[model samples]
Target: EAAAPRQSVVRRVAASSELVQNVAELAGIFSCLEEAFMVYSTRKAIAIDELMEGSRVSSVVEDVFYVLRKCARRAVATGDSDCACSVVNHVCAVLSQRLYVELEMRVGQIGRNKERTLDLTREAQYEGLMEALAEQWPMVEGSDDAVNTSSASALGASAMDLSTVSLGSAGPGGVDHSVLGDGSGGMSSTISAEAAFWCLSVNNVEAAADNVATVKATLEEEVRLVFDDELESAKLASCIAELDTVRNDFKKRLQTGMTKLCASLSPRLRSALGVMDGASAIVKYELTEAEFADNDGFNPFVHEFLGALERILAPHAAVLSPALFRTMVFKVAGYLAKQIK
Candidate 1:
């Protein structure tokens, strides 16, 4: 019932070019208006979770700054302060409301999550300010120089516009987009800065879950083959040392795999959430303990491994498409079965 006015405003902003142009004429007063909006929107702080919602806020904000900065530069290049002012003012009027509305939503959500302590609401409002600038700039698409093909496509950035802003070609405090990607798609030194850290973490968790079972099963087999019947003390000691070495190596490889996955997404997202770390601990096994125990030594190893794998993949369980998940589990199971030889 109360949303009608806001909806009407949204419609006006979306459809009425005259409204935007009129606001542009008042660009001289925009600074004051913007301050008021900022104060209103950021009356309360935001939570980390809301700020980090799927990393969209960061992307949106980045786009905003990139576009607005370009607009300012282009205006200066053309000696058209009025055009630039209009664009900036138009964005503020329209996007400021969006920010205010989103912040209102956040305020409502605050009571829902009682455990949240980190307030980033102010930061989010600042981000909205950036996004406001971006939303006003007319562009076919947005792009990020920091990520590889995906980010390139997602951000839809070019050397002259968005990239220019980040590189600070127009002003101070600009970001260097070159650090986003090397020709080799490695993102090189800038991978650590990507925000989509979850991609890397999730892939690592997936790889670990998939391979841990097979590695453990194979190592155990090697140990069994070497030990056979009861051996002499010297041989027993040698076998134990070999098994220990294998176990250590396996753990190292697991870490390496996880690191590699993170490195893979460095160019795309400047940072990542460690969600995969938590997700890896939530696996569910199909086999019961008694059932695993019934299979003797081999059964317990496979059962436990499967359980861990399931938990590691649990976070992805509800994804709209389960085809990939099913395939991964099938591949892991097939590998374990084949390794039995």
Candidate 2:
């Protein structure tokens, strides 16, 4: 008797070039998923706190699942049962199990304030994604439904009927596949749709978070430089220049509807508004020759300058008003003078 065809191996003698290409595409899809995971891990390592604000975890979860859905669609198209089974198992395990765990860990770390913001952002993104997916996976209603009886059924069973599966009819909560091995196997639409929603949401939230960080950092840099003894002569000119530039940018953002981002820069705004009028007066505040000489000397070398400076400046950095900054300068000058004596 003739031996039955091997279900696990793709026979070169029997498989067409197009079928082979589809199998190769499945491998490529896995590579893409692995690479994306690597990128997500690296970014998380750099700053889990900040990235969580950006919705990095949710974004990666969505991206990996979406790609897996596409992989399943293409795998079924190849008409190779073994390849399709492998595709389904591999994609599902990576996206739903492994990727899900990694994402959960980061999501657990998000602060309550950021978590609320992320929830709102996700809802908006989900609606937009639902509309977009609607166009991609149009479903047709009919009385006849096509079914598969492949051995690949060992994989997760999807409610979606493989034979009748269209991109649109696949819906959002189940798996839809073109074909599978001798048993039965398929992709889950629910996971895929959920992932797509979160991925888009993360992109949106991350952009907004980054904008806030950027504005806060820029303002802090200028505010700190205001007290740099090196820049005493140019203090007024520099403070006005920097604050004016920031104000223009702030006004522009206000015009463009970035009120929330503007609000986030409250510390910067308070300092700028209070300092613009007082910087010149403080700069011109006359220092007595005795006051300067009383201090050990100008710019005396201190071995523990950084540590000591941080100890002195930590509290002040938080509430650095013009008067406060001036106080810090005189205090620091006196401390430095005492260090030598």
Candidate 3:
């Protein structure tokens, strides 16, 4: 009976999975959030690209800014403060640096669109916007964690009303996490475990957001593909099958792929886990749905998975993290790759 409250508390922690259910649930959430981000991001990029190409649509500016507003709110709501900050900063930069003045003079108002109201050409107006955003930044309530890349992607942004997310709310900061050690003889497994625990806790909001992004992207794209006239319905239906295939493939390959990544890194993981020899036995084959159902690889696989997790997070361990360069380009590529070609 005493364990009940403790169990709930455990359940509340970010990045800590008491069992398979927790793991699966977290993964599902993040996947959806990530996919939403993809849609938001893709559309935003496309619109801006069109504008930059000198395609004059007066409402384009309105739509573009409108999307930015949503992107900002989405970033915050989805638990990605970085994304929120990035979008806000980016808009500010664009308006400040570019010819908001020249555009107002030249582009003018083509047709009646609400965006025409935005005569952001003056330096004073631009300065005011920057100032207003600065003042409002604190109130925006972005995620507390910076390490979660997925959170950065989704951005929980909305138009002018970003009520869903707080500028700096407490999320996943105190959650429990599984930990492991790096192979330097200096650190203890206990220490390593505790560190990993902290890492996951801090990054919980972002990680969850990232997973949500993936899910949203896949489902939305799948739906679009289904409804799209350009796609042959019979071929379009295969999107679902492709999803299942990817799901099974990803699940089976999670630990092994991670292991491969870790193996490429310095201070190898297997050595630290004291499972260096099992690496071969560990990845005899890729996991399929049937194999996952058998409950066969949980123990060994979990170890390898966590090991990889540690490596993925290694570059982030610094007080000032410098991880995952060129992540945006990858997102763009991912977006194009998902299109029905």
Candidate 4:
């Protein structure tokens, strides 16, 4: 009876030791995976040349998920739910911390661009106004200091006058909205590059969502194959729910990014439409029959507005996916209809 009690104690010690060893092994696996994922993410972050070269989505979207699948399968093969759960949770952490943050930052850049674009537009308009003024009033022959004083006073007066003038107004001294349409004005390569990166960020979110679903399905299948017990599979299904949350988060970000992009285009669209308003105001419906006959039925404002819109949207259409492009078009159309109403 004493020997039986001693044997029981020995068995208990062996069980405890095995549990500790298993936990240590699992910890090692988790550490290795975490380190590997961090390295991969860092490498991809540094290698942004592909994004600059017009890759629609970051390669990390595919690469990280690819690694996740392999790691999840390996964890499942161990037949330990703790190991599998730890690894899956780590995957979610990596995605939330790394990929999601990167995407959010990229979308944030769009907001900054909106302000920068407006500032550039204002600067260009100021420059155009100064040029127009210099042409309209030639500088008088005088001392350099006198000329400077005269120029500064004229600019200050013009700036004050411009502050009250409507953007749509046009006359001999009025600001020319047409300048905004021409390539020589405010549009720059930097703006185009920012737009391209925004498109890529949006595409990356979409691609990442799809990849997450794919990886989840693959991991689930592997889990089922590895674990014969229904209860164990149920536990894994619960674990996989974490991935579903990540995918949903990605979808939400995608929608947010698209909405922001559409909103950003609104000011430009309104400016284009403003040209039509200005033209309509100056239309002379009481033209003589002979003058009407010579009108040639051309609406210069409509043509100008459309040309400006095409210039504004051409880069977006070229970069965005067809589906996304269609969504943007529909949204723009709805916005126009609302404005018309």
Candidate 5:
């Protein structure tokens, strides 16, 4: 009886030791996987070039998600709910803290840079106007010689005003003026590439939401098949809910990005719409019959304004997704209507 009791105690201790060992090994595996994911995601995020060509979604976005799906599937294949949950949690953290933040920063930079460029263009136009006015009406106080001198003084004063404004200026968030331009050919390319990248980011967010949904469905199906225990299945369901949260986050970011993009583009459209003010002034007066019939009564300013608007929007059509492009169009139309009113 004593020997049998001792053997039973030994067997129980051995079983407990085996369980602890299995838990430790599982933990070690999970830790290694998490570290590897972090390194891979960091490298991929850093390696992305703003100038890289992408149509619907960025290559980096696709690559990162591919790795994430593989990792998640591998964890699920282990038939361990805790292991799967650990991987999912790590994915959410990587996306929320790293990839999403990077894309948001890029979009913000583009908006600030674009606003600065628009400001510079407006300043240049003002300078041109001042020069033209000085040439046309020389601000003469005394003689024809005085006319030239006075005009020169006026031009100098205008230049000083422009210099003061430009020097004092800072963009939203106090962005450095150097980012607007550096008087080099490369700067133009950089700005263009960044703008294209901004568009890519918007599309990538939309794609990410879709990809997350697909991943959730796949993981859920696999979890149901692999986990027969009700408790394990329930735990997996809870883990999958984290993806739903992530997908919602992506959706929110997508909306915000689209709104910011539309807002950035608005200034350009508003500048183009300035011609309408000139047109309104022209039409405020009574037109002669001949003037009404001129050029089949087509307003030249309207035609020119439409052409300018088209030129501004043409590049966006190719880069932005269909839904985003439609949103931009509707927003522009509403703005136009409001301005006209």
Candidate 6:
């Protein structure tokens, strides 16, 4: 008798080819997640505390889930065997289960003013918020055109059904076949709708997270070594001094990064705003897992996010030098370790 196919194994086999496009794509996604997490962790080394801004922090959280969701949708839709491989790359998933515990300590440091954050959290959200959102972002594409100020008349602000997407006969730039193993899996969607590109990062890439762990551990060790064993007491204080300077600098640049990210959204902000309306209900979120599973909209955000990040980084990279940006990873981890320790 022909052996019954193992869905897990079949899925794994299917995902392998899609991953062959460019290995860096996978790593880059993980690295972005790791960088976000490390920024959460190391407040001491590079001083990424400004990433604590509530809206900014929320955006980062949204970004993490978005990429993961995108990865998952492609994995399931295509039945890629390497699905779990992508899941494993998520540092957010791998962190200790009590991970939420860390949020308790950092909440105050990472958000907008308390009264404003509280006011924004009222049970009933306003329709004006939607209008504000629509006014900002009508439609966005990867190609850098001026941010569209037009509004979409797309009916209600309700949660959308994603399965309706059509992968018709190919049109220019609308769809392109990505390299994958054993061929036979290229369904293309019209480029007009909201979707992220499946470039080198998410499609055929594998990222490793252990390197980040090593970076964290080493920074901690170096910091600890400077002050004897009393991590708190140990302050040749030059490290602390540098960290303070770094944090201030990182904060300034992060604000700049956030502004760029925000400005870039002028074209896609409405979609994201619509996303915000449904976000609470659809994915009320679970302590155990994200609220909603990967729907079709998820896969495309990968492309959208890359476009957003590029715009955000472009304006701010000059304000923050490459060395500091690289060190931000270590500094964020350092700060977090200090906070919890």
Sort by TM-score, best first: 5, 4, 2, 6, 1, 3
Model 3: worst 10 consecutive residues (lDDT sum): 152-161
lDDT of 3 by residue, 1-341 (tens): 99999877875774364674564555456545644554455455433432111111223334434443454344334333233334334433333233132232222221112233444434333233223322323221122221221221111111111111122222332211222232121111111211222222222222222333354354344445334434333333343234343334323333232232222222232232223234334433566787676545344434443443333333323210112112222332243334312
lDDT of 2 by residue, 276-295 (tens): 23432112235577856644
Question: lDDT per residue, candidate 5, 94-129, as tens digits?
Answer: 777777775665455435422333355434432332
- Go through the candidates in order and give each one's C-alpha lDDT: 0.33, 0.34, 0.32, 0.58, 0.58, 0.29
Query: What is the clash tally of candidate 3?
Result: 42
In order of appearance, the predictions have TM-scores of 0.19, 0.21, 0.18, 0.62, 0.64, 0.20
Write one digit per residue (lDDT tens) for candidate 6, span 247-271.
Answer: 2432443444333322322333233
Off by over 4 Å in 3: 1-239, 249-253, 264-341
Q: How far is 341's C-alpha from truth in model 5 (Å)?
A: 2.2
Per-residue lDDT for 175 in model 3?
Answer: 15
Q: Model 3 misses residue 115 by how many Å?
A: 47
| Model 4 clashes, total count | 0
| Candidate 4 segments whose C-alpha is farther than 4 A from its true place | 1-49, 52-54, 113-191, 280-308
Question: Candidate 2, after superposition: displacement of residue 187 in Å?
Answer: 40
Candidate 1, residues 38-85: lDDT per residue as tens digits?
Answer: 333333222222223232232333333334334333332332244433
